[model samples]
Target: MKNELLQIGPVTIYGYGLMIALGILAAYMVVVHRAKSRRIDPSHISSLTIWSVLFGFIAAKLLYWITQWNNIIEDPRLLLELSGGFVVYGGIIGGILAGYVYCKKKNLNFLQSLDLFVPSIALAQGFGRIGCLLAGCCYGEETNHWLGITFHESHYAPNGVKLMPTQIFESVFSFALFFLLLYIAKRKKPDGFVASLYLLFYSLGRFVIEFYRGDIIRGSVGLFSTSQLIAVLVFLATCAILISRWIKSNRVSHT
Candidate 1:
């Protein structure tokens, strides 16, 4: 896990930032391609992506800050650090809200927009997790089993220990999810179905994956970590939305 990809005197390129940048590029490409297929204007897609990503970063940092409030209060400088530590859940929440606002302002159908973008989100997540692997942030519990991967140089992960490659597992799952959702979309499914499925599937996967994660940065309460609790809530919310949609569809069909 090499955090510094390149350095020239005072300038240095970070692995996490580079991966995030690549993820954004990949997401933008997929979004624009899907938008064209759906007859959505490419310019609008660009604007939406730019705004969503900007707000996503802001929201992610804010949520991370909230989680580490005690540390911030003690040092006051941790808040200003430009290093790693941005919660994915926070970014998702912020991106949704930001997308909602943009869609409303542009008079676009929000759910449909979300459907078009959901698969790309999964693809981007897969790449982002790869970034986590490179930066050695979201590590997994130490294991002596054959599946365990060692990160000897990672500052965040324990050196010279066999740790579960949870980041790689998550990356693979996200990529698989992207394909699944993309197939669902090609079937011409309901507007919000893909987005709802993404929430349900990703939340459930993240909850299970959290068990293997060794990162101590994530806060926990009782029997679940912060991400696990959020995952449960997201799954429940998605279920409620799906139920409501089914009820509405039945009523409309009856009429």
Candidate 2:
């Protein structure tokens, strides 16, 4: 709804892009504030975040291309369409990889840096989902429920039909998760706990939400959508990390 928020002369501001820009700015500001509180150099975090985001965009686009490989092969123009078709998992993975490399180069504690910044990722996602809702990209299955929303001008969603509004649901969940992560971080939990919790909760939420998504363009793996498959793997991997960390912590305490 209202994808074109404003236009003057040859300049036009689109809803999705505007929301993304806001989200990135908000996330960076939060990270900077957090860095000051954590006693880490805000300048370092600023550089790391910028690098992670740039790589995250590349990863998101790359994964989107992989998913839509067939469509791109048929119509090569789809490859250049940058307005949509990003995979969240790809972005997450890429950001983590970028952060890891940056941490290695800067001699920063990888887990500590990860824990310090993970919450901002969720914060950014909250705004990103609102972008999705505005652009009507990640729509949900048709439903007669009261929570359904109708998008008349959505280029992606079916017009005149009430849909489940998965984008809003995810946005709310992301905001809540952002707050929860902040709370957990304030509690002074273990080094890796916050990062693991972020992965665990996000993966679980994404897996469940994938069931309600109506966009078949996202592709599937056997009985599950592509995101669902990735979610399961992420969840299991996170569980394994948590268990390993817990056991190691117990051993350290006992020793």
Candidate 3:
């Protein structure tokens, strides 16, 4: 739950910011390696990566502001604080849209690009969860379980007690998903299959994990968590996409 990693000559480096930088670097490396394998000009990926990350951050902040509209209205300055509160789903939506547009303009296949990007996104998210753990945000409800973690002096912690450590749980799950996607990629499944599977699995993981979150929660219709609402929508959308692809594949097989 330590925010400040070190101080040097009156300058303080925040753990959260460091973790984000590391995540971006790790994602970039994966993207470059993937581009090389596909024989796509790596420079195109480099350019698209910049746009994706820039838009992703803006979308993440915007979505967080929307979620915490009351707080932002009370203190506009809070919007500038990058320490926490960013939403990963918003970032993914924004980044994917930006990347798709860029790929279309360059005459690249959108599904192939998405297949290359999704695993890296999962890896980055896994790293970002570590940041959440260190920054003491996105924590879990108190528990007597052996996996409990305590963030005693952090802003995200309501009570000075041990909690379920949901951040680490998500991180481990995402890391496993990352490897699974990489493995599935080698199998040469349908172009968009890996990305669709990524969305399905990630949304399922998020839906389950949101139940254990101890932070302030927003409700949608009928006792549903805000994230749960979004997850359900995304899950349905993913199912539609998978079904459409299956139908197309079947038609081609019959042809």
Candidate 4:
């Protein structure tokens, strides 16, 4: 994996940053396209997207700092030395919060908006995982399996050793989920159903992935990594919400 994918005179294009940009663009396009189909105002989506991304980055960095608190306290300079450190779940939570606030302020249907955007989130995450692979950030533990990959010039991952390539596995899973969500959307499922499924499935996938994650700097709680803990919470919360909504719908239908 080459971090510095291209260099031109005074400018350099890094693989991680480039993939992130592409992910954002791709996600936006998907949102706009879906918005048109749903007859929702694309302008609102534009503004919401901006707010979500800005807050998402902030939250991701904030959570990363929190996880690395002890290290930062020991060596304050380490914070300045590190160019990048972010937790994906933090970004997801921050983005959802931002979108919720935006929907409330605009007086829009929040569930409908969620249904429109979650698939795109999965798509963006798919791209972001590829970025992680290229930058070698969320790498996997050493493995001698045929699927193992070795990175020679990774900024974070151990070089010259065969690794599990969990990044690719997650990327593939995200992409598959994106398509599945889109298919579920076309079936016109209940409002928030798609979003709930997204959360449930993503949390399960992430929790399982944490086992293979090699980076121990991400911190932990009890027997689980920070992400794993968050995933479990998200999964349970989504399940509870889904069950409540189903019961409420049933009651309304009966009445």
What local distance difference test score does each model get?
A: 0.89, 0.92, 0.86, 0.92
Error of 4 at 225 (Å): 0.9
Q: Is candidate 1 or candidate 2 better by TM-score?
A: 2
Which is superior by TM-score, 3 or 4? 4
Clashes of each: 0, 0, 0, 0
- Clash pairs, candidate 4, are none
**lDDT by residue for model 1 over 1-255, one digit each (tens)?**
788899989999988788888988998998888888789988889888988888988888888888788878999988778566788999998988999999999999999999988898899899999988988889999998899988877879988899999999999999999999989999978789899999999999999999999986777868998889999999998999899989999999999
Q: Write the per-residue lDDT of candidate 3 for residues 56-99, one digit (tens) a residue.
A: 98888777778888777889998788756777788988999999
Q: How does model 1 fare in lDDT?
A: 0.89
What TM-score do all the candidates reach, one by one?
0.96, 0.97, 0.94, 0.97
Residue range with the least summed lDDT across 10 consecutive positions in model 1: 77-86
TM-score of decoy 1 = 0.96
Candidates ranked by TM-score: 2, 4, 1, 3
lDDT of 2 at 148: 96
- The CA root-mean-square deviation of candidate 2, after full C-alpha superposition on the true structure, stands at 1.0
Model 2 TM-score relative to the real fold = 0.97
Return the lDDT, model 1, position 64.
Answer: 84
